[model samples]
Target: MNGILIIAHAPLASALRQCALHVFPDAGSALAALDVEAHTPPEQTLEQARQLQQQLGMPHTLVLADLFGATPSNVAAKLVDGIHSRLLTGVNLPMLMRAICYRHESLESLVSRAMMGATQGVVSVAATAPQNQSRRTSHDQDQHDHQQ
Candidate 1:
């Protein structure tokens, strides 16, 4: 199985992991997180990442970081270059959740699935809502006219 790791600036990595565990309930062991603090030396952070890699154990791990060029991503990039892991940036709840749901798949497949989730999760709702909202608005106006 490919273990999952999330790395991001302070709180975000852990925060996302916490939310994922809340949904998965049994993901505490399979999924790990590393939160990068401003003062934390790169070497120490890299060490922790090494341990996380061990904790996950196995063929590979999928490491997700928040920003591509940020500290969290940079630190993670260092450790995952090893054969046992792969890294994807711009980690989000949707991607994490999707990955957790399908963790048993191959790392490459999970990467594609999770990436789709992350990309699709980012969207803007139409300025005008669908027909349901329009109908509700019309009904509300009719009620107001009746009261008058």
Candidate 2:
């Protein structure tokens, strides 16, 4: 499995790691995080990233950041040399879980699965309500008729 690094603002990276570990205890061995604070210097964070890559054995690690066009992502961008290191933004629990589950897959496949997982995780409650809405409406109508 390629190494997994999560970089996010403040506690987000750490929190995501913790949450992922809750689901897959063995995943803690393969994942790490760098929480970037506002005062964090770019050079220092960049060096940390370099070390993380080295720890992950480089070029085969998937670097996930919390936000695109932001500091965490900016730092993560420097790691992508296009050799084998891949960078993906918008880190979330679902994406992280998918990555952890599919780590055995090729880097490309893992990235694809993570993206799919993240995208599929987002859902609108209203969209799901319609399935049982008719029953609810019928019950309410019956109650209203009795009241009348």
Candidate 3:
């Protein structure tokens, strides 16, 4: 099974893991089967990312980071050359969820898809909703309810 490792400064990684679990209740089992590791802590996160790559026997690992130029992103940057990992910044729930579901993909492909998911997730609701140019007064609801 291929592995997906998330590296964030302090609580972001764990918080994302919890959110993923809440979104997909069966993810624990699925994640275990896919060798996904969602870890956080000042000491072990980067090391775990490195070790997971080696253990998975893959030259590359897909690393999703919370912010660019931050500790987590910096740590992930260090592994780029050695482990063939791709570091994606601005990591969010959509990105993490997308990454977990598509962990089997190649590093490049996974990064691309995760980024797309993140971008799409940040849409405005008004833009998505159909525009109703015809304005209705407050009495509209009252009139329908009275007739019923």
Candidate 4:
């Protein structure tokens, strides 16, 4: 199986993993860490990721990061030249779950799927509503009844 590296900002990795577990349950297989607070240091994260890639014998590593241009992302960037890894920014539960589910996929394909999952995860409730006005009204009524 391909390896997954989750590097998030501010210790959010643990929570992200929990969310992933909630979605996938059996997804406790990949490697991940939360280093947004500078606990592990960027250099250490890079080394660890590289070591994990080597140990897992995966052709490529998929790194899901919390923010773009942040420390975790930058650290991942440094390893790009030496390892077959893809760095994705703005990672969320949907993206992580998707990556883990498709971990065995090629690096390029996994990255594309991850991006799509991330994009689709972000949606306005109104946008998800039925196009028919009556359906929307009924939906709103149901929501109101549930609140009462």
Candidate 5:
């Protein structure tokens, strides 16, 4: 299985990891996080990331970062060699959760699934009132309601 590593600015990386774990309690072994602290040098962050990658101990890894050109992403870009691991920016809870769910798949497939989750998870909610919508019938029991 491919392991997942989250690298982002302070708090964001760990926050994403905790959210993923909340839904997947047993996934802790395959997931890791590295929060780059303020004033930390890129070289130091990269070294720390390398340690986390090693601790993940999987044949392949998928690294997620919060921003593309930020310190986290910069460290991750150097951390992955493109053979055993890959990096994806704009890490959101949806993307991390999707990656964890599909960690058993090939790395390439996992990356595709994660991207799909990230894009599909974002939507503009309608402003209609609850009273304006029709109620679900017994036949709709199998359908999942995504709204809160």
Candidate 6:
């Protein structure tokens, strides 16, 4: 199975991992997270990420980062080689959950699934009632008599 790794800003990575764990309690072994603390050296963060990836112990890993050009992504870029692992930016709860759910698939396929989840999860919700149910007005009256 492909392992999943989350590398993001402080607390975000761990929080995303927690969300995945909430949905799939048995995913601890196949998943890991690294929160890049502020002021920490990139080398240190990269090393920490390497350790987490190794601990996953899977043939391939999918690394998810919060932003494309930020510290988390930079560190992750240095960690992935494009063969055994791949990196995807703009990580979200939906993306992470999707990765966890499809971790047993090929690394390339997992990346596609994660990307789809991230993009598809974001949407413009309607302000009106769900399913377009009409709202009741004062003009509406009871049709049945209650007297017994």
Instruction: Candidate 5: list runs displaced more than 4 Å.
Output: 129-148
TM-score of predicted structure 1: 0.82
Off by over 4 Å in 2: 127-148
RMSD of 6: 7.2
Residue pairs with backbone overlap in model 2: none
Pairs that clash in candidate 6:
none
My TM-score estimates for the predictions, one after another, are: 0.82, 0.83, 0.63, 0.73, 0.86, 0.86
Root-mean-square deviation of candidate 5:
7.1
Per-candidate local distance difference test? 0.86, 0.85, 0.64, 0.73, 0.92, 0.90
When superposed on Cα atoms, how far off is each prediction in RMSD?
6.3, 6.0, 8.1, 6.6, 7.1, 7.2
The window of 10 residues in a row where model 6 has the poorest summed lDDT is 139-148
lDDT of 2 by residue, 1-148 (tens): 7789999998999999999998899877689899998998988998998887787763488899999999999999997765577899999899999999998888999899999989988875533334445633564534532211
Write down the lDDT that model 4 would get. 0.73
TM-score, candidate number 5: 0.86
List model 5 lDDT by residue over 1-148, tens digit each: 9999999999998988888888999999999999999999999999999999999899999999999999999999999988899999999988888999999999999999999989988989855437768756567656655654
Compared with the true structure, what per-residue lDDT tens digits does model 6 show for residues 1-148?
A: 9999899999999998888898899999998999999999999999999999999999999999999999999999999999999999999988888888888898889999999999998987645444567654555487432332
- Angstrom error of the Cα, residue 77, model 3: value is 0.4
Ten contiguous residues minimizing lDDT sum, candidate 3: 29-38
lDDT of 1 by residue, 6-74 (tens): 989999999999898888989787899999999999889889988987988757899999999988888
Deviating ranges (above 4 Å) for candidate 3: 25-45, 52-59, 127-148
